[model samples]
Target: MRLLPRLLIILFVIFAPLPAFAVNPDEMLSDPALEARARTLSAELRCMVCQNQSIDDSNADLAKDLRLLVRERITDGDSDDEVLNYIVSRYGEFVLLKPRFSVRTLLLWGAPVLLILAGGIALIVFARKRAGKPTGSKLTEDEKARLAELLEK
Candidate 1:
């Protein structure tokens, strides 16, 4: 029916994922290889303005500038590492979408595992203490004598 088709269309319009690449046509490199590399690098770099989003996914002005800088570096024949180092030098390690593991980041990478292990150990200790405890109190000598006398009577 016509109504069914219109409802389906409306649902599709509401639910369909639209393309959301933030790169403008002018920002793209002419060379296919360089453009691909630039895109890859852009995806790794964090947008300063939109701290949670990668430069590739962010529509921020700073993201645009970072994209341009990546393209410029790739065109200048800098290796991937060189380009990353250059950016890190300028913006600090926080500019990377994924922070590189190093001695400085050891605590950040290890804290969760350490915490989970500590929690498991604590839980085991608590369970042991609970299991070892007697649920009912032992009867005193007077209570035992009273119980025996009551039974005889």
Candidate 2:
């Protein structure tokens, strides 16, 4: 009976949703809609200091500054597109979590496929060369005779 309560408490603790933001309580917008938009924008912005983490998930000082800048832009009545454009203009496309598809990004995305195709072609060529013939020259008649004589011994 006591185990049931303990198990319930453990399950509740294990399954509870933890807070997801590194945004301080003081940094949050009072307007829930604006705050939600800020959160969304923050999530889309990459943390330059922590390359793999979104600004919203990063605890870096630069990320915090970016969060504040986003909120400031929102409060200044910038549309979501305007804010994103401003950030991109300031920080370049690399600051975006999902970069816009463009010529440069297309190259970045396509280079690996191109490399793999090249590698596969090289591998096929190599395999064909390897399969074409045995690696060494055929033994001469004299060498064969000597090999047979040695084997008999």
Candidate 3:
């Protein structure tokens, strides 16, 4: 009984998903509402130094700077859209964790679907070609005659 409990605890410790925040205490805003908004915005911004991580979860100096900038913008009474626009202007659209759906990003959004469709079409064509081919080998007349004669012998 004790072994099972210990195993469960070890598995939980190894596999549990925990939120890993990298924001320092000093960077947080005093106002709760402002802090919440800043946090939401931070989660949407990419860490330039750590391209795969959001600023809220990154420990890079650039991520820290971006987090501060977001808080500063929120404190100045900038709405969420305004803050996002301001950051985009400064850092380019690449700063956004999810790119906005627009003409410029259409290719990025459509490429996966296009690739899957192409794969499906190619698979269907390959299956048809395989199905159309004869399954058994065709024997020559001489070979068939030799087989009949051998069977008689």
**In model 2, how many backbone clashes occur?**
0
Query: Which lDDT tens digits does candidate 1 get at residues 17-118?
Result: 875889999999999989999989998999999999899999999999999999999999999999999999999999998889999889988999999999
> What lDDT score goes with residue 6 in model 2?
100
- Model 3 TM-score is 0.81
lDDT of each: 0.93, 0.95, 0.95
Extract clashing residue pairs from model 1: none
Could you give candidate 3's per-residue lDDT for residues 22-103 as a string of tens digits? 9999999999989999999999999999999999999999999999999999989999999999999999989999998889
User: What are the per-residue Cα lDDT tens digits for candidate 2 across 1-153?
Assistant: 999999999998987876567899999999999999999999999999999999999999999999999999999999999999999999999999998989879987888999999999999999999998888889999999999999999
Least accurate stretch of 10 residues (summed lDDT) in model 1?
12-21
The TM-score values for the models, in the order shown, are 0.81, 0.73, 0.81
Pairs in steric clash, model 2: none
Alpha carbon lDDT at 79, candidate 1 = 96
Query: Candidate 2, residue 60: CA error in Å?
Result: 1.8
lDDT of 3: 0.95
Q: Alpha carbon lDDT of residue 16, candidate 2?
A: 84
